[model samples]
Target: MQAASFTGILKAIFYMIAFYYIFRFLAKLFLPLLVKKVVEKAGQKFQQQQQHSQENPWNKTTAKDEVIYNTANTKNPRETKKVGEYVDYEEID
Candidate 1:
């Protein structure tokens, strides 16, 4: 069996550090582009939804479809009823 050597351990550490820096560099270059594309797609979807809402017929209100509620003739249904008599108790210390 071949025992681990100092050079082999150093080579492994170097490879790990190189891989980390390379990944960081690539992410810095491409991450913004990926995020920009996502944001633009979301903005387009939001604009489409706004346009759809504006063009919908049910969202428009007209004079004939207006509703008015008369509250003056309404009766109050929440008349309070007594359930039990209150009993006061003195604290004995």
Candidate 2:
């Protein structure tokens, strides 16, 4: 079995530090551009939703609609008519 030497350990540490700095530089260079693109996409989506709502009125119903019911205003009482005949049932065991 080959044991790792001090030089190999130092090289690994250096490579890790180099990779960390490289990733940090890349994030600094591209993070703002990515964020800007995301914000622009969100704005465009919101505008499209607004325009769609404006175009179609069916999507604009709020929670405050008032329901009105009109009843009959007759002076006399409503005459009730008989509807059905009652049936007698017998059970056998």
Candidate 3:
């Protein structure tokens, strides 16, 4: 009876460890899907802002999403912001 209980407990522990790794693998796989959703939402927001600006021609607000991104590799800090037809300066103290 004791041997049977020990075997059952060992099986249960093995199953628990397997389940934990499976969960981690699934989460890693779905991470890109989550990122894609976020990027799509950002694009929609940018489009709405563009349409609103078109309706109000007098508004001089710049489009934040006009920037293009290369998902390959980009590490330059300045590359994050779009270099539009205007100047943006930050004071360095």
Candidate 4:
């Protein structure tokens, strides 16, 4: 096995720096295109969802289909119950 040399270390560092710069350049060129396509796809999906909601039968209601709840005829379920006797307490300061 060969021992590690200063030249070898320098070469490895150079390669690492070169790789980092190249990766950054490629990412700068491609990342925006990828992001734009993803955003467009998401926007299309959102538009499709909006269209689907607009076209949905359940979302449409006519005046005759409206429901009116008569709360005046219904008795209150939570009537006042006498759980305990009221106590009058006087505090002296």
Candidate 5:
């Protein structure tokens, strides 16, 4: 490959600096709008959840039922279901 001249090196440095500043300027201009949109979406979701929880008492009860069911089933369920069987093994050398 041919050697890079001083002018070529200076042009490359100038192009890199130009791109860096352009990126920084664009980010500064758009980052706030992006953050605002995300915050608005989260706020809307929070309000929806609040409205749902307020409207549906059964929804809250179902969540509690799930917690209770999980804990109760692991220990002593009302209707027992066999999951697995114990096996006895002997090793000989």
Candidate 6:
């Protein structure tokens, strides 16, 4: 009785592993093609939009951008040089 039950359990486990490998193989074969189709469709839509539009918001220039300097002041600020005041090191014994 125990032997039959053990055999059935082993068979079930083997079938589960086989099914897992089959699913993984199918995914590997078709997943990339599915992704490629989605990307191509999106790219086609974007190209159509660009061809129909004259001025793109992405390329528009704003008033703030025309300023000579992005900073508050127009003249460049001078950076102060930093000098080390002191240094110490230990000698090998």
Whole-model lDDT values for every prediction? 0.92, 0.92, 0.87, 0.93, 0.89, 0.85
lDDT for each residue of candidate 1 in 3-51, tens digit (9 for 90 to 100): 9999999999999999999999999999999999999999999999999
Off by over 4 Å in 1: 60-74, 77-93
Clashing pairs in 2: none
Measure candidate 5: CA RMSD.
8.3
TM-score of each: 0.63, 0.63, 0.46, 0.63, 0.58, 0.48
Better of 5 and 6 by TM-score: 5
Candidate 4 backbone clash number: 0
Better of 4 and 6 by lDDT: 4
For TM-score, candidate 3 versus 4, the one ahead is 4
Model 2, 1-93: lDDT tens digits are 999999999999999999999999999999999999999999999999999888987946788888875556456667889898899999998
Off by over 4 Å in 4: 60-93
What pairs collide in candidate 5? none
**74 Cα displacement, candidate 1 (Å):** 5.0
Candidate 4 residue-wise lDDT, 1-93, digit = tens: 999999999999999999999999999999999999999999999999999988896857676766799896587666787899989999999
Model 4 error, position 35 (Å): 0.7
Tens digits of per-residue lDDT, candidate 5, 1-93, equal: 999999999999999999999999999999999999999999999999999878986545443454344575678657777999999999998
User: Which 10-residue window in model 3 sums to the lowest lDDT?
Assistant: 72-81
Worst 10 residues of 2 by lDDT: 68-77
Model 6 per-residue lDDT tens digits across residues 3-74: 568889999999999999999999999999999999999999999898767556566767666546477555
Count of backbone clashes, every candidate in sequence: 0, 0, 0, 0, 0, 0
Candidate 3: tens digits of C-alpha lDDT, residues 41-82? 999999999999888887465775375789656554455666
Who is ahead in TM-score, 1 or 3? 1
Model 3, position 51, has a per-residue lDDT of: 100
State the TM-score for model 5. 0.58
Each prediction's RMSD over C-alphas, in Å, is 4.3, 13.0, 19.8, 5.2, 8.3, 5.1
